[model samples]
Target: MKNAPTATNSQSTKNNQLEQSQYNTESLTDLSTAAQRARVLHYLQNHRALTTLEARHLLNVMHPAARVMELRDHGYKIITNWRQDSDSAGRLHRVAEYVLMAGGDA
Candidate 1:
């Protein structure tokens, strides 16, 4: 005999799937604030610019603006450009694109 799936179980499964699809677990598994800031800075150095979506999906930083602000406070020159982008869930949003103008203190 086998037990059938309940509504709660099905809903939980859907939520899990949604969460998995929304975030890159491999990149986000373990990262501290400093690590995320470093990653974002390195990425900006190589890429010259980074969008909010890129920060979230590629760098695994949930709050890119906060990281950017920290970098700015550290004397890094960063500029923000607004643009519309679609998230993992295909929802349109006005996201900030941060462009690195100059490097600051180490």
Candidate 2:
């Protein structure tokens, strides 16, 4: 009987969950968009190029194009190349791959 959760324990659990949710939301929102874009830019500067999937997988960025545009607006010289790739099923598709140019903070 002691192992069972009482009404007070249930209310406390709900309160704890709400607090945790608020904390998580605040922490996530505290990461500014500029910081996210900078992560993408740094990856490009070091790795030379990045694709949309690579950006999502490596940097946890949902929209790489948006980040690229932000970097470009900040005066970063970035270039895009359309790459033709085949998937495991032999389906062909085009992907926009981004590369930092030689000039402008490269």
**Best-performing candidate as measured by TM-score:** 1
Model 1 ranges with Cα > 4 A deviation: 1-28, 102-106
Clashing pairs in 1: none
Model 2 residue 59 distance off true place after TM-score fit, in angstroms: 0.7
How many Å off is the CA of 24 in candidate 2? 17
The models' CA-based lDDT, in order, is 0.73, 0.66
- lDDT by residue (tens digit), candidate 2, 28-65: 23345555566776678788898876776567677889
Error of 1 at 34 (Å): 0.4
The lDDT of model 2 is 0.66
- Residues 29-49 of candidate 1 have per-residue lDDT tens digits of 557665677777778878889
Reference-based lDDT, residue 35, model 2: 51
